[model samples]
Target: MRQDRKSLAWSTLLEIDSQPEGPLHRKLCGALRSAVVAGRVTPGSALPPSRVLAEDLGCSRWVITEAYAQLIAEGYLEARSGSATRVRATAAVPNQGQPRSNPQISVPVEFEMLPGMPDLRTFPRKRWADAVREVTASIASADLGYPDVFGHPRLRERLAAYLVRGRGAAVSADDVIVCDGTLDGVVRLCRALRSAGHTHVAVEDPGWSRLSSAVSTVGLTPVPVEVDRDGLRIDRLRANTLTRAVIVAPAHQFPTGTVLTPARRAELLHWAREVDGLVMEDDYDAEFRYDRRPIGTVQGMDSARVVLMGSLSKTLSPALRIGWVVAPPRWAEALREAAVAVTPPPVIDQLAFAAFLDAGWYDGHIRASRLRYRSRRDLLLKEMASTLPDLEISGAAAGFHLLLHLNDCDAAQAVRRAARLGLRLVDLDQYRMSARTGPPALVLGYGNLSDASVPEAVRRLAEAVRGKGTGTSCG
Candidate 1:
């Protein structure tokens, strides 16, 4: 009986009640709270009646009531005079979310060079607190009815202005849809495309792997298209007759950091026009270009053909969980309908974000983070040159991460050695679907390290690569 109850709770909270030296009431409360938070019991989902749950757990009725009361006090459960107890709506885990294969599973966290994570330690907590307080006090009570089915109007207006000025996107408040993050935005668009009869979509060959779930979750096939020096291969894109859409990380392609060349951008526009297939452009980190001025966004070339995804996750913090999709006129309604079907982020958080952007606090925070991260990137590059010279580098133009190719070396073995040394690093070959792989490369991220620890981290990595100095080059 306890095992059955434990299984049910795991489906909701991913945590089982610990075997404790406590009374039955405490254990029962822990199990139920864990179950609700794990999403086993969704918002508005009701709980078993107190008596029914008591009978199932083989506990007294009063014991179950007290347990339910504890959950209610903790804000994880709710109760009414006659209605069954229900789960309260609350954020369960941390870091916006992960690939989300199991919404119930706790987000996976280990070496985390999986890509695009911001240095969250640098989040402007003081500024955020001020903004949150201001919004919480100022927002009218009636605004809490439900999320603006289309997203917060104030955020839309602010995001449109920011995108046009900063990212070169063509959008109006009406054209923007707020979402949890890029992956959520993708899920929304993919669902809309499916509704419109789009079955197969193209994704870049060593693209964001999360797309496997985000795109397929909505029942569309993610067709793999190769990306080379120019960007997404136009030849293959043009050749595919069945392609109905495409997803591209054009700003600084994930893991590789290659910006899309101008010619390719034009070619992409031409293809979108000719094929009538929309391009969902993820223009992340366009604000932090170190070498060249960040190029104008692909969405600006033809707003009718491109859907733009931009987020505060890298610019601010992933914990903010605020992102927007600037859709073409055709996709606006479809995206909103899909969002309504799932959990839209809390209204209060959205309002706070809108206020933050409106007050110009968002821009101030971005500029500070950009300067700090740029310094980290430059130091990491210098350290790599001084400490590990044989490594070939690419995708270093922008973003928090850059890839270093170990010349003709055993990438897998090097990664294992680095792991053994407590130095975390990610391999690039795993990003590819085909067996034809790139050189032995490590995707190193720098934004999280303190100034003093940068060199020490590189020093340890160097030792790992040498295998204590056998120094065999992979070339």
Candidate 2:
């Protein structure tokens, strides 16, 4: 069989005899340097071994070594003892002051008001490092092997206890399955439901677009159920019995930020029981409530019919990719099979998180973050009150964002205008499944902004809405 491009490229040897410009080693060095500069060989790609290259070129190994050494001395390549010699990271072919034939253009963003983003600046790095070091020193050698796929037993136990106490989740260590992230858990849940003969899954009409896309990608239809002030309309859900599952963010509904009332919660749970359907409860951002008591999860009420998914994406950084799915004991086998279909997250992080939780660092971080975000929420309310008094906001009591109901203005037009003024904003109409429904609104996220910039960004938004001139700069 023909070799691959990378292997064939590496196997090529310099023809020293044909090139009479300089010594054999010099010629070899020139050829390799030219290849690197011309971009034929990419940076960080390993070259053939000196012995193999010399044998192929009918030269002594010392000659190849000398040429490689020269290239390394000239900063064209990198070499380390016992490791393959490779091109340097900055070895890309020079543009020589000439613009590329097809230059890619990039637009810079100034202020980002996108929702569901946590204040990454508040992540306790020192505490996390300590937890990781402690866990690494204490973890067993055997625990480093392939993880339990479901989750590490210690971490699962820790999470089960934490959720039960903090989030009001009804689960035990045996009923939990660790996942790469919330999206991973959702995908797995959908596939498992599909395997169990579910063809339709209901989602809120003005819900996260990615949720619907995930359902469609897994070969199941997404039934769009309208959401009211009280939250997902239980009556509409009752009208559709074929929908096998419904996903919700009840604690703090996305974009709109409405909490599911007690009546609606009970009605939805009763509906699930009657239809024999599942409720995928996404307890998104339930940790940062500022006004009221943290809403209890539906899973706490009926674990058998509810599969709760929560992640570090909101409370912690999304880059950690740590989340869990707490299911009923009967679905444990199905969830496990679903988990095996996808690669689990790194075991070390799982263990480190267990240590963090066990040491109470996780709870400490939550408390501190709650206070920090609450301050930001207060700042946002204060700024909006002064700049845009007519702006109606909701869902400020919980989560990192608030819902701005736009009156007498187009949400899409406002978004475009705000973007031109260097403010990144999202409107509610973008989240709808069909044509724009109800009144227009905006979901403003303040988690990523500093205290000083929050007021400026909102002021720019107000100016954009009022047809005033653009701001000076994004800063």
Candidate 3:
């Protein structure tokens, strides 16, 4: 078998060697070099012994040895005292110029305050490792095969129960479809909706751009319905007659951080029922409410007309890549069918998460995260008030971020100025589509910001807002 494989591996070399213009040894060296450079002989693959190769090629052993010596000098092959000659592990096509370095597009800032980011430092590493070890030890061999396209049965069941108890979502394990993350869930649902003949998806005006972009990527137009202090305007949704679908973060909307009022929630459901539309609810970051109980999911109001989507991105770490869609029975089969072409989250991870939920570690983590984030939010609010007394802040009741309404300063200008002073900021307009008449504001996230850094962050932000540049470097 090895001889057969080597014969196939040397086919390219044989092709190169058939041309006989140079010394036999030189030709052999050139052929070997070409094979290695073109990856016909992969790195770390053992080359046949010189005698065997020479006999196969009908060449003198002296010719083979000289060729091997030449190629080894070229840094393409290596030989040990008693082992077969092999391709060097680092051998590759030689670069013609200076090697390129990866772009630093996402390097974290000294004060990274990106909205929707969880406090990664607070991730329960020990508990998660315990869950992983337990799952790996006991997972049935049958469970390691091609996973259920929708999700692991155990994770789906645990998620369904957790959603019901915590977010008041109306769901069952059969209704759950696990995905890579919330955006992934949105993409899958959008495909299912498109398959079901839907064309337009009504999204919040200043909503999460990633989700809206996902809708458009799957060939559906994202209609930007205006959101006010009361959450999505049902009247705006009703005016858009062409849309039979909508996506919302009703529990705690991103950027704006407004909860859908009971009245609007009811109206939105009524509109969905009237138009036979489907509501894709993004339940991102609904786990942290500082002042009151987190609002119940809109799906609980009318499960048939709403599909709830959530993930561990905001609750735990986005690195986990675990998310789920709780679809109503009407759309469950369509979602499952749409998921057929996509790979679900790893079964091991799914099982570990299930064990985490079962062990109550997830709940304990959430409780601890909520308290920590609430404290950070309070500190940020207090510091901002003290430093920029005139700045009006809103959306502090829940979620990982709050909006700082700039009455006099330009939000875009402030973001640029803040960057120079080592403060990372996101303007409210980044989330806006057609509607841009709101007051200039910055969306400040305190989730990843340390409590000790809050005072300094606020100080830098104040300098930026005031158009004052302090020469102090960001440490």
The lDDT of each candidate is: 0.72, 0.78, 0.80
User: Whole-model lDDT for model 1 versus the true structure?
Assistant: 0.72
TM-score of each: 0.76, 0.76, 0.76
Instruction: Please list the residue runs of candidate 3 whose C-alpha ends up more than 4 Å from where it truly belongs after superposition.
Output: 1-108, 436-438, 469-475
Off by over 4 Å in 2: 1-107, 436-438, 470-475
Ranking by lDDT: 3, 2, 1
Q: What's the distance in Å from true for residue 355, model 2?
A: 0.8
Q: Please tell me which predicted candidate would have the highest lDDT against the true structure.
A: 3
Candidate 3 residue lDDT tens string, 75-132: 5766543346777765785433433542222233568877878889988999899999
Checking candidate 1 for backbone clashes, the offending pairs are 12-38, 12-40, 13-38, 256-395, 407-474, 407-475, 408-474, 408-475, 409-474
Write model 2 residue lDDT over 1-475, tens digit each, in one string: 2123347444354334455597677788888887778766767777777777777778887567657755664557664333467777656576545544322212347788888788888788898888788888888999888778888888899999999999988889998888877767777888789889999889887887667656654556778888878889989887777896999988988877888989999998998888888999998888878887687899999999999998888887988888999988756678886565455678889988998898898999999888888898899899888888877777748888888877777777777777777888887876787555668788889888888788789888887666665432110
Q: Deviation in angstroms for 231 in model 2? A: 0.9
Better of 1 and 2 by lDDT: 2
In model 2, the clashing pairs are: none
